[model samples]
Target: MKTNLVANCHKAITNYIHHTPVLSSSLINDIVGAELFFKCENFQRAGSYKIRGATNAILNLSEEQKSKGVVTHSSGNFAQALSLAAKSIGIRAYIVMPTSAPQVKMEAVKQYEGDIILCEPTLEAREKTAQDIVDKTGATFIHPSNNTNVIIGQGTAAFELLNKHANLDAIFCPVGGGGLIAGTCLAVNSHQNGCLVYGAEPFEADDAYRSLISGKIETNDTTNTIADGLKTQLGDKNFPIIKEHVSSIIRVTEEDIIEAMQLVWERMKIIIEPSSAVTVAATIKSKLLVKGKKVGIVISGGNVDLAKLPF
Candidate 1:
């Protein structure tokens, strides 16, 4: 919730990121029973807000630091973002991703010209493989959420959202590793807009919710939910930021997530991943409420493989 971090992130990532659009849908507002604004990061470059964080992390690097290239581990979106960003700046990118990452994401990373290292589908394995890659290649390790620059960079979304919709009373974002919510907390609550920032997590893997209630960071004993994108444990850095500035974490289920994904695709005409659908699901499931007040929900990514989607 540092003001300086938000300011620095704004300054650092301004040239690199999009001021992703915020649109109000009477259709969504009617369905959700709230006056709603959608911060459509699903429409963002790299298909996600991950680009904001990834680009910030890469562009902040010193010439000497970037000389060895950059390495990161992701379920999908971050890998694609880093791949695209690194390629743009003429830096090499090595991405360690779970084998279970959506085929679409894996293909996108390869399409963006990243060197992909596949590991078993778990954060632990992904981290280990990423470390091994870094050790051998001398590439700098860029954590998806734990990195400060990355967190700050991710906050730029809220900065843009608030600039566009200053009156929003609340904002809901999907929580994976907690980077997006952490940055949002800093940008929205810790700063001038003072919106109530809530995080949505899969009930199947509701680490952030438990961590918030328990007053400590918690990892799910076993990951679940179709939101394969939200499986990472909340970060140490992000936990503190959420505890400080975020209002609450809302939990939803795989059923809820799939329903939400279908809603977005069918009604909103956006192809959202289940992870991104968490926010919409939380809003609809009455796990959280916005009522007559203005509400903002971030669509985190749209990289779901339709062939893999559950109808």
Candidate 2:
């Protein structure tokens, strides 16, 4: 993807999306021995950066496509994101969520007026269900992470971050379906300052890390990580960008994720989901990599079940 794609996307969605703040904590900075800038997308619309891409994708759709509406299979942030984005534009949103998804997540989509189709808790089921909706209703299928407009939208978060802190030595983000990190890679390329992009993933669900090493897409043997959002593997659309531009993928243990989440909550007094915490955990785990540098961490989301928090 070109840098202009991300730059233009940020400009296009500026009015529609929140310009989330970059927060810092001196205590946490001291612990990591680096000046850490947290791009707090946890405070973003739909409670995650997913809304930026979701909004961009829908806004770019043709009038005919908008008339038929849109459909996607996501049980997490993207479901709510597409629902809210489509709702904002007065279009119908069909969200296919897995039966095993948390009831709270399903309720959140319903709150946004998304018509939910229940399917078995498998990627195959989710894809087939979403396709069935597209076949029946002619709704455009917007992939959560692989769509080009969506990647450009996701890049806007880091684009805004780099615009505000162009001097950052490197930026780290949690990797899942790879949209955000791939977008981040594109955003970093726009700056002449040579800011590098890194992805933080859980050891339990480290397909991204393994994929980088194997030089092809890799799947997780088990989706057993506490960072539920990072369980998905990379896609053809984003994986190429990741392979070319991302500096590396850092793997952190489950204990590291929990400790990092607790640290952010206690020190920064912010509620970050485990996926967001992976970036911080990676920074802490690889302290020497960022020592004495100005580093940016993308806090991806804050939507967590309060009753089942890891801590």
Candidate 3:
């Protein structure tokens, strides 16, 4: 829970994870009326920021734990991240992916040499399958966004961002299970004063926003947004940190999400998934809030299915 834990994680996985570039867009700044710094985690290994946490989690495991292997249930980025990290570290990875997960992501996991366990497309089924794997193989289960090590690992992205741009007035990130934003909160608090942290969430799956208001975790009745990565509900581990440190959760529409994704692709010439665009969409939606300020937008990942693009 200490901010210094992020520093430890960075040191542990420095050789393994990429210190992703922080790029700016003059046009985006003009549009949002703020100087925007985009932390391009899309270019990160495994094409997402999840690798930071995945690598740190694996590296922190004891030799015996490493021998037994690590497991996680993720349909997209984290599945690939854990697989690649484990492969790089010479440990086995057990990935429990829902059958409805994109074929491209599943293939990427396989490409990383993950042992895939396909299950029904339900949270219950995924968790049960992962637990079964742990029971049978004694593999350690790493929750994608809820584990302490994972959260500390994720904070390294913001830590890097702040290391390069220490004077940022604010930082924004997309919220799903709350790991990224929660870690970001610790990063901003540890590194700078008066720098706020905000979370962008899809209106279709605004559990984080509602959870903030309700002072408890909330679930979605249906996740019908293009931002598949932001559909998951907040977890107890990350929700407390988010509720304590995040300034607010801005909900953006599906159309806005697509527009933002298209803008980054066309203007920045960078490929980003719908989840990554939520921060941009929210920034644009709340232009006045960030006007005349220096803001950092954590582009969560770029693991989009090109063949199934919304734009």
Best by lDDT: 2
CA RMSD of each candidate after superposition: 1.9, 0.9, 0.9
lDDT of all predictions, in order shown?
Answer: 0.83, 0.93, 0.92
Per-residue CA lDDT of candidate 3, range 1-311, in tens? 47678877888999998889999999989899999999999999999999998998888899999999999999989999999999999999999998898889899999999999999998899999999999999999999999888888899999999989999999999998888998898788788567999999999999999999999999999999989899898898999999899989899998999999999899999999899999899999989899999999999898877778786
Q: Which stretches of candidate 2 lie over 4 Å from their true place?
A: none
Question: What ranges in model 3 sit over 4 Å off?
Answer: none
Candidate 1 CA-lDDT value: 0.83
> Lowest-lDDT window of 10 residues in candidate 1?
284-293
Candidate 2 residues 5-98, lDDT tens each? Answer: 8999988888778999999999999999999999999999889999999999999999999999999999999999999999988999999998
The digit string of per-residue lDDT tens for model 1 on 19-72 reads: 777767688787777887888888888889998888888988999879999999
Arranged by lDDT with the best first, the candidates are: 2, 3, 1
Error of 3 at 240 (Å): 0.8
- Model 1 Cα displacement at 171 (Å)? 0.7
